[model samples]
Target: MDKIQHRTIFVNGINMHVAEAGAGPAVLFLHGFPELWYSWRHQMLALSSRGYRAIAPDLRGYGDTDAPPSSASYSAVHIVGDLVALLDALGLDRIFLVGHDWGAVIAWYLCLLRPDRIRALVNMSVVFHPRNPSRKPLESLRAAFGHDYYICRFQEPGEAEEEFARAGTARIIAKFLTSRRPGPLCVPKEVGFGGSPHTQIVLPSWLSEEDINYYATKFDQKGFTGGLNYYRAIDLTWELTAPWTGMQIKVPVKFIVGDEDLTYTTPGIKEYIHGGGFKRNVPFLQELVVMEGVGHFLNQEKPEETSAHIYDFIQRF
Candidate 1:
């Protein structure tokens, strides 16, 4: 395998720490919330060894990257702009894009904002559904997802910021790093979010005390506020994409989700998604792969399967 190297790239006036390697085509990997570029360790090495240039960045407010304080700064348009600027900084006009969770959201928007800059896209976990301008504000969304409404709650500023600092951010970081598989308890049950009670869930076999400690230490450097800012962008995201509302994605795209992912089980979900949502969005969409035993954190839980699928997809392109 090719050795990975670390470097910081300045984009959008903020310096982002990137882990990259390989020598052929450029593939930028964008990580999800609560995770750093460290999450893509397997993909970086595997893709690099296969003669593909793989790059993973610690996004604007995560990891070793700069964390600006304004919620306005973290909106989809701005985040997407950051990616474009990153490409400019790297002297690349276009590249393959892969994103997970919040990264996926940004990936979807990036394709919408600047199709010329994206060669193809792979969005995992989070599906791209355009914003509903007619929909009610946060409360309606909260009602839809319930206690799983943490993302909506995160819009409330100060709540997530103070909670992490006060409730031992270390434990919060440990909860995510130690989780091998997605559990029902990842969010609070009182809000009807998915997962069992905190005590009922079992830690994944893969997580070790040291792994948890490492993430916790990183979280200690910056509070959860910066991470939470991503959630504060709903309105801004909606307004920003107003022009692209019925537009279909022209780039080659795929959606990968785990069967056990709670997203599939949400009530009235299919209709909501299919009713002029994602299905109407990505026209050139290639495939949707639902792995049987995997959960939300598929990359971490089943790295071999995830990497194999990713490699297979890229080969076809």
Candidate 2:
């Protein structure tokens, strides 16, 4: 293991633990759910070797960061604001942003809310599925998917938090990190995309023995409350995003997803991506690339390819 120096910084009234290495152009790496700054271990070293200040942080409430107790504190607005304050704290004016899963959600919001502070954007495994202001309630979405939808289960207060807590973080992490081999070319009917429930499944290939333990240890320390707060804010997210309902991200944007990823296969998915909100909001968008034979955890599954695509995109600007 290459030893990397770690530090603690205060942002948005919370103490954030960040792992940093290399030095050059700024590339802020943000991890998704149940993951820590360690999620970008490879990318941080790779980019650092190539003259980039690669920084990854355990976003508020996930790792060493302070986990606020209220769901209201976890809004996308607040998350993005934290990122802004992070930059301010570091005295950085602009940066190349990279995020996955829930981190991608915050990345999208950050780019929208403060484009001037971001030099470029790269998202993996998650798409910019804007909040549907008039879409059916999360309950209706859950009822539609049933046991197949884990997200809807998450939306219900206390139920998911309690269930995941009882099951333990290791179980929850295993469920999402399932295998990537394209099996049957089918999307489970129960897990709807864009804030729908996810069917329980086995862990994916990307997670090795050490990876699992790493995540489990963090969950052991943080519990799932802070991470769950992101999901709990669905309704609040909708209400907050109402102001930017028609706002498209004008920054140079790129969305990457695995072909085997359940996200791209949801019914009416393409319409959602290419029509209405997306088209109107992202004016200077880049292409969406789908990697075959890969699952949702692309960075871990295929680091060389992920890094290549990201560097290529950043070089263009």
Candidate 3:
């Protein structure tokens, strides 16, 4: 980690903090919610040592990046614009891109919007879902998972933040990072995101107290609203991206996921992935890996294997 270099770059109206290591072909990493550039620390270090430059940015509304006041500001178009701008600012034309969770969603959109700017992509956890032009994203999610589903629950402004506040920042961070529970995460109003202040979340062997502290410290200062805003803007993103409906991602892709991941366990997702729907949407898809027994945070949960998988794929390019 000491080998990594940090800097701030002004991109797409926000000051994005980027962490970089090594000095070869750039491999950019985009992290998901409740995480920071720190989420890619292991990958950054491993890749750097193996002769690839690793870049991980705290995306807009997370970590040190500027948080716009409106959820509408977080549309996939806006976030992808930020990445394109970041690449330009750093003079990178196209690079191998890696994304997880929300980052994976954004990466899919980025490729859809501007494939010329990406060499290839390795997306984790989330698979690209072709846009349903007729229905808003929130509506579909509400119908499928019900209102209590985490994404649906995060739609209302200030609601999730309030529960996060009451639950305590670090506790909530620990809860999210350590959760191995499969299926859709539905936080019923009665239970809250923080199950109980007294509930002790046993840290997984892969995640250290130091890692949780690194994330909690940042969220403690930045607040969860910026990250939650991603969810809050789902409908807007859906509407804005209506034109790209049915557009297939052309870039070569390698999709990896933990079999135990909530997204993986969600009803019909397995069918979607293995049932040929995923490949239909991601036409250039090269490989699909389902890591056994791993959970959503597969990269962090199994850094060595994850990093090796990453190295093997991107090195070919």
Top-scoring candidate (TM-score): 3
Summarize candidate 3's per-residue lDDT along 225-281 as a digit string, tens digits.
999999988889988988888799999999999998998999999999999999998
| Per-residue lDDT of model 1, residues 171-202, tens digit only | 66655544433332235534232223354434
* Model 3: colliding residue pairs: none
Which regions of candidate 3 fall more than 4 Å away from where they truly are? Answer: none
lDDT of 1: 0.74
> Candidate 2: deviation at residue 176, Å?
1.5
lDDT by residue for model 2 (80-132), tens: 87888888998899999999988888898998889899888998766676556
For every candidate, C-alpha RMSD to the true structure in Å: 3.3, 4.6, 0.8
* True-vs-predicted CA distance for residue 16, candidate 2, Å: 0.5
Q: Which ten contiguous residues of candidate 3 have the minimum total lDDT?
A: 196-205
Candidate 3 global lDDT: 0.92
Q: Where's the lowest-lDDT run of ten residues in candidate 2? A: 188-197
Error of 2 at 61 (Å): 1.4
RMSD (Cα, Å) of model 2: 4.6
**Sort order, TM-score high to low:** 3, 1, 2
RMSD of 3: 0.8
My TM-score estimates for the predictions, one after another, are 0.88, 0.86, 0.99
